[model samples]
Target: MRKLGTARPISQKQSARKEGTRSLAKHHHKSFAKKSRSYSSTTAAMAQQNLNSLLQWSTENTVAPGATQPSSDPARQPAQLDPALLAQLLGGPSDADLMRQAMTAILSPEMPQDQKMIAWDNLEQLIESIDNAMNLTPLGMWAPLVQQLDAEESGSRMMAAWCISTAVQNNVKAQEAMLATGAVEKLAGLVLGDADQGVRKKACNALSSECRNFQAGMDELVKSLPEDVWKGKAVDAAEMDSVDEVIGKLREIAARQS
Candidate 1:
């Protein structure tokens, strides 16, 4: 009877030990699963944050001290183009020479930000004033500017796109020349890939202008743009709207040409 009692208690202890071991194992598994889930959620949230940051525009404003303010009176604003300088640039110096000088001023690392802005403004006006005479061919004034579309400085890229738009607007010769430089593809890439809103907008403007009333230009622009860009993959809502607007304009142009 004493042995039986001792053996029965031992059996109970062994059963309890087995139950405790199973419970511990179950707890450990649950803990590991919870940790894995937590780690995955954290990683996903971090990735989402990074994606949002990349899509968001910088809100920093750095206005130059002496920058001109907007004026209600049209005459108060500085002339966009200096007539004498335009004539000299177009007729006196070769397009290559003028482009080199403008690019040097615009791209110089040591140049003041304000000065760079001035250079861009001047370049835009010069290209606009010259119209089709700016020559966007391989050896034209716009060759260097097209290369600047990929510049490290966002401001430079924006200005370059703006200049290309101004140069190609309503100028079939300039459009053809720009196309020859493979600018259509480059501009489309900017429209789809550039993070800067200003740069993208300017690139879209350039594409719209290039495609206006020109069948060949329209074809080139459409072909250069990727289907994914129009589908709005990875683009923010606002940026997607901008892309849509550009596509709408291009389609309109195509319809008109057809």
Candidate 2:
């Protein structure tokens, strides 16, 4: 038979100490698990928040009133509101405009074409708000946003191009204000390669008008128009004029520049 030794309990304090050590170890393990879970939960939460922000920015960049986004389809673009015009509205009520907006909101779904015409009027009002003789700085601030909206959609680009053309033709001060802010470059960018040929034509027409205003400093741009646009489309491809007209004007500017 193997010899057996009897175990000795040294004291009650020893047992208590051993029990306390086990209790401490168990508490430590539980705390560690809790901490791990907290870290994992925080990581998941951060990832979800990032995804949400990206979605928000994507929608905003695509359809945020005046921001520009070319469509996934070449034939379409996002809708636009006149940022300058709307912002101006926020500052004070123009009774006529508010009435117009109410009418538009009510009739837009039922009579889109008519609504579009009224919308065009509203767009003009927005442009003209900047042309107010007293508000030069406000108009200047709006130039970039208007330029951004110019690229957003064809309908909007039409308003911008035409309004600018009218301004250059009739309002010397508005032309000066817009041009000083490089509105011509912005307008040219709006027209070039636009999805709507009409918009492109309007753009060229607007630029041509500005160039004719010899004081606007857009003459150099006029003189630079070649027989063909950079995309190899003759100016007539805009569907607005004959190539001869474009060439003649360019020749005119060339002669003037000389």
Candidate 3:
């Protein structure tokens, strides 16, 4: 029989077993927490990686190579003129009608890019035909043509410059209108500032044509000509030749006028 007030002795093996179980539980708890932290860190890193990939994809798709950034100015927005509408407008009732229609089509924002180019080429041909006829007395056309010198499309600007150049060819009235409408300043700016060599050449030719026999045109050209023309730096070799030709013609015109 057990004596009163005396407790039974716990076996060393049982005590050690209990201690081992507690130690194992603590170790498991620590390991579980470590694993939870690791899982959380991995998930966050993976989310960050996914976010970076999405940004990269967005950037790659948003802008095309060599594409010009969009201008904020509404005036500089891309033309929206419909090609069909352009064709309809170009269906001429008269020379004045044709000129007005052509100008409208060129400036309209609805025109397709490819068709816009075709329209410009056709307009140039039309202008050339009118100039050859020597009956292009519609001085009103000069104002819109001058406005196109500031068109957002390089093609539009080039065609406008070419048309102006052709219109002034042997036409005194057209040249006077060109000067009066302040086209000389815009043409000079194109010559000095346009990125396209073709555009620069066309502007140069237009300046020369306008200034050939007109003293006022020559004076304006002299005033508007960039100093870089004399410096000869940054000008392309072929473009420089055109520039030199225009300068020589201007000099000739000045001498004759003097």
Task: Indicate which candidate wins on TM-score.
Answer: 3
Cα lDDT tens digits for candidate 2, 132-177: 4224344343363346335445655665576566556545666666
Colliding pairs, model 3: 79-109, 80-109, 80-110, 80-111, 81-109, 81-110, 81-111, 82-110
lDDT of 1 by residue, 53-116 (tens): 4334222222357966567866555444444445333333333444444556676788665456
Error of 2 at 98 (Å): 7.0
For model 2, the superposed segments whose C-alpha errors exceed 4 Å read 1-119, 125-141, 190-192, 223-258
Worst 10 residues of 3 by lDDT: 1-10
Residue clash pairs of candidate 2: none
- The segments of candidate 3 whose C-alpha lies over 4 angstroms from its true place after superposition are 1-92, 130-139, 227-258
RMSD of each: 29.6, 30.7, 34.5
lDDT tens per residue, model 3, 31-89: 54666777979857865765665566566546467877557866545455444344334
Every model's TM-score: 0.51, 0.39, 0.51
